[model samples]
Target: MFYICDERGVWPRRQRRPSDCSSQLVRVKLIGEVLAPFFLVAAFEPIGLWFTAPIAFAIYLSFLKHQHRTILYSIYFAFTANLLILYWSGAYVGVLPWVALSLLQTLYFLPIGILARFSNNIPLLISSILVMEEVKARFPFGGFSWTRIAFSQINSPLASIVTIGGVLSLSFATLLLAYLLITKKKSVAYVLLSLSILPSLVSVIQDSSEEKSLRFTAIQGGTPSKGLDFNSRAMGVLNMHLAESYRSVKGDEDLIIWPENAIDIDPLENAIVREKINELIKRTNVPLLGGAVLSEGPTNAAMLFREDGSIGSIYIKRYLTPFGEYIPLRSISEFLSPYAERVDDFEPGQVLKIHSVSGSKVSSIICFEIINDGIVREAARSSGLMVVHTNSATFAGTAEGDQQLAITRLRALEHNREIVSISTTGPSAIITARGEVIKSLKDGEIGSLSGEALILLKISISDYLGGFAPVITLIISLLWALSSMRRKDNN
Candidate 1:
């Protein structure tokens, strides 16, 4: 009988059993596959294990052995990763909704799973990830775009790709290097790594110029204690912002920006509210972009107040958050949970308004509006400065604020413009065009950020193309995969 030895061509002719060696390898591979995705979950939010993201994903892809188990494994991986990253959702809306949302995100990975099963080519797999993320960014009520692959790389070397092709480009380049490393394509990996260094070098050159700038003050008013109840105490919330506005004033600010919902009551309708806001603007002798809730069925808006307290143009929030702002399928949602009653149906603004504030064309995105690519694209095209006015008081103590800040950093790089993101209940920051956080206010703190920001009309290639890169790449990948499968079948 011929023996199949585990140890092949040993120096001393030592032989090992095939079953034991094969089983050991299989066990190691399985353990690696499972552990890889767990680490991927850490790539987001507070933990920010960003360096592990590409490596973890590469390991997961390496062990994708069976076509029949592709969907099952992918669902498991995506669900677990999303569940960990989005766990904070449970603190507000309950565990059920969080689980349901995580499950929904799994479908986004289904296509990538199928693609991985059919091909071993690295580029195709990377393209599949982009396609999955692109699809998930759009569906099910303007999709949950948090924890995108590129978001993990916000602080990494790959961030330089943002100015070139936006978030999708960074993701593609990272995955390319990751795949090459996993496949042991050392020569190609080294070459690509060298090329990756070029983007960061180019970014440094672009941001080196000292240009004209305007000094601005950003106010973060701590909520009347943190929780969902702060919104109920509208007057107190407004007073808090008013007080902070007074405290933050340095007397030299050319412009002042407040966090979203700074005025819980409509200033246009209330003389008392208008007077208080105008008082601050007048004292500072600077224009202020203050957030307010307008009561034509409650519109979330950022109204620009001139030095004399005269109202300039208003930029109302265009993308209203589905559950938080307006409960979808209200009747059904209310029946499911009592939390639905807490949210009033907020009307979305029809126009993407750009305001000329103190010589700078400002595109203000209120709160969650920063997540929408189209909204951000319009903002970049319309103005030289981008401001994200947000209130994270409800999600206080959670990683939601940090995650949002990370996304804002990506936006700064993507547009090659400075972003002043001011949030209530802390973590207000100033991000430069290079995606660097020059200044910041920590979460759960009451403070202000003062910085000099430049006005630049430069629009990135990614901004011009919008979602074209991912959509076009997705179509090409799917077609290529189909053609390859057909050729194999014919043979």
Candidate 2:
């Protein structure tokens, strides 16, 4: 149960043995530690990514969590594990600057580790993880919900279960699956299994509304270069995407989607860019939902420039990247990740935005927001479909990023919405409501995929109307276990 802790500045020292794995406490910590990340990462194996990054993260968190160590240890481990991979790959670019950023992010796990101390058994452990996740999701500048377990379910046929269960429900479903599989619990596992598949089956059966495909085109214009200054080359990046769009635009394509940072110009200003957008829509004769800065700079946003000669609705991004968008400390951020010239700061939108396009209201959670299951749920509650606009120009070239993309696909299934994720680097495609990638372009690949595919926009689902079911189920399970624990406590 030992772990790293720092009250203000009192740093805990490391364990006596880094290699030793004999202690029961350590073994429990180790197994529980690696289990979550292992299955999660394994879920991404279908994609090109090696299953190590997520697994390594889980192992590091295990040792770091229970070691008598410094807060700096957690930070350093987070930074080092990430940087070590990047440095080994000879990727001398965006990741180096992110070393510190990763360290800062590791703090999110600190409280989760602390909460795990109360979990004496498997059920409690699972409940504790869910509760800790819920807590981490709320505060400290809106918790980073990256790497949710639900995302890993994309490749599995179980993804359809998301239609009825939702994201919160996924944790329970995933855990039960993990626990039963890991422990070989075949006796009563049938009920849990049935619970998972039965709803999705009924949903597909009861809902036979035929899907209507909308012809759409999505494009990702490559950056000027991977290395060197990204700030000065903004115009170059913008032009490249515009040019790519021109090549990709087809008469039959009804909708065109660009990555989160597609528009290099500020939506409010930039007369020439404005004129070009109108012209592009007019020429293509189709709606283009492209990413841009709304007010200025870091405020990443999306705009729907329709072909009908109207100012397309603007969607300002609600969740902004904490350190990247606006820095933590003014002093540190100024020196570290400064706002690019002509870019003030990313303005935050109040909530998730869904704009009407081609007779469908598509809910969007820009870039980093895609990882947040809660945000996706919020948007899925009131939209025809969900889309994620992302920019992964800053990542370890290894397929590690694809793991996140897999999560996006799983999320599509969760809400039963067609998730069209258009990213800056690549992996842009149309993910079906079943969480399978129908078609996708790899990283840094140029061009677009346009075709008429049926997209179902629903009024609402049973899960949507009863979101509290997931939360309530979690509460009942936790209370049952805790009550049992209390009985044992009295006994």
Candidate 3:
């Protein structure tokens, strides 16, 4: 039994052709690489099977480890997965922007694949993912963090880990689980799996009492139509929200919240709209916190209206949707989206505003801003309760709304704070600190959710350290890579 050795390790004389072995590897697992994204897609949104995420990554990482063309395979995997996860990006906009965005995002995976090809170090692989996520989140028009692995684990036992290390920690644990399972470390995997749920278990056993609570109403006023034109009937949208608030308010509520774009008309500029809003506040005698698009700066803001209809603290959205709210590269964007020319560039807010409503400090992030880790974490730290106002009318009839809800749930868990997620055109939910959806209105449903939201002041460990986790991971990974290369050179 003569033996041979090559870059892939030793094999019998009959199997000594490493090229043939590489070809065999590609041919045998090509289907797995192609289908791996489907499992990952299933782990998120409408088809939410949170457990499938690990299985999908195990398959994906296996290919990166053993395949000859890791970079190419990684591109294929990332592009396919992104296309599925971000299909809603093209719901109203044309396919050009959708495909273009997906391709651009896919490039972020190249570095991970390149690193994987260099070494199969577990910590290196895991840290590379965190680094990639962190970079993509800040680059190319304020990065998209929607497709993060932690968002997919909102329902899994791993979600509780987010409280300790934020989304990065949860993502680390998820990948660690996949690696452990792939390496057939069942006992260790089981131990990790059990330990992941310990936070939730402890939370349940504890008093879980609230220092204070607010009686609030979240209005999900359905749009007349769905698409880019959903708000074409801008005044109608505002009226619907007012109608819902009037119908839902029992006069005892401390605050009434509305989804983003609830007031497409500039309430300040339009006297009629202003009077109507003031009338709503006066009648309900409740502080009105709603999403409004102001004519000045053409800003997208969450406005807090006092009982006298005077505007209080306003949170102008810090992070705006790249192609949606504002068009970048005007001529090029117009070429891709015919409606791009109509988009007026909204100015980004420079300050973080936390509204004081009925003795409770309330924080909020508008629609797309919820995906921004720093903004979300800072908002959680500044206030006792958080509210997310989103308008999914553009991406209505798609999985986008559900996916945003999933992310919202994770944010709730990450900071251990109750979040009231209000979405125009449906799926408004009041999520608990533990990421449980206690009450919700379905998609396209015109209704309101009135509940007592606990004002929790306890800050999670993630709130304090989550922002630093990725940077730390990247530094450690680089140090390890350098050490590994030194050893290779010495040999």
Estimated TM-score per prediction? 0.90, 0.76, 0.91
Q: Which parts of model 3 are misplaced by more than 4 Å?
A: 1-28, 186-191, 194-208, 473-491
Please write out the lDDT profile of model 2 over residues 106-139, one tens digit for every residue: 5655554554343334455556556655655565
Q: Which stretches of candidate 2 lie above 4 Å from their native place?
A: 1-119, 181-183, 296-298, 332-344, 351-353, 396-400, 459-470, 483-491
Candidate ordering by TM-score (highest first) = 3, 1, 2
RMSD of each: 4.6, 7.2, 3.9
Model 1 agreement with the true structure over 1-491: per-residue lDDT tens digits: 12233343111112233554455655566687788778787788798877788877777665452223667788888999989888877777777778877888888888877866666554566667887787778887877778688888887876777776777767766676666656566655775676468766766655545446778999898888676776788788878877887888888888888889888889899999889888887787878888889999788999998888888889878888878898888887776567889888888899988888767788899988888888888899899888899999888999989999999999988888899999988788999887889999999888889988988777776776777856654665567546645665211
lDDT of 3 by residue, 1-491 (tens): 12234664523233334444555554455677678988888999999999888888888777665555778878988899999899999988889999988998899899988987777555566678878878788988998888988888888877887776677767777777877756766754885777587767656654356889999999998888889888889989999999999999999999999989999899888999999999999888998999999989989999999988899989999999998888889899899889898788999999999999999999988999999989999999999999999999898889999999999999998888999999988778999988999999998899999999999988886676756756654575567547756665211
lDDT score for candidate 3 against the true structure? 0.84
Which candidate tops lDDT?
3
Model 1: CA > 4 A from native: 1-17, 66-68, 115-122, 187-191, 201-211, 471-491
**Against the correct fold, how does model 3 do in TM-score?**
0.91
> What lDDT does each candidate get?
0.78, 0.61, 0.84
Candidate 1, residue 206: CA error in Å? 5.6
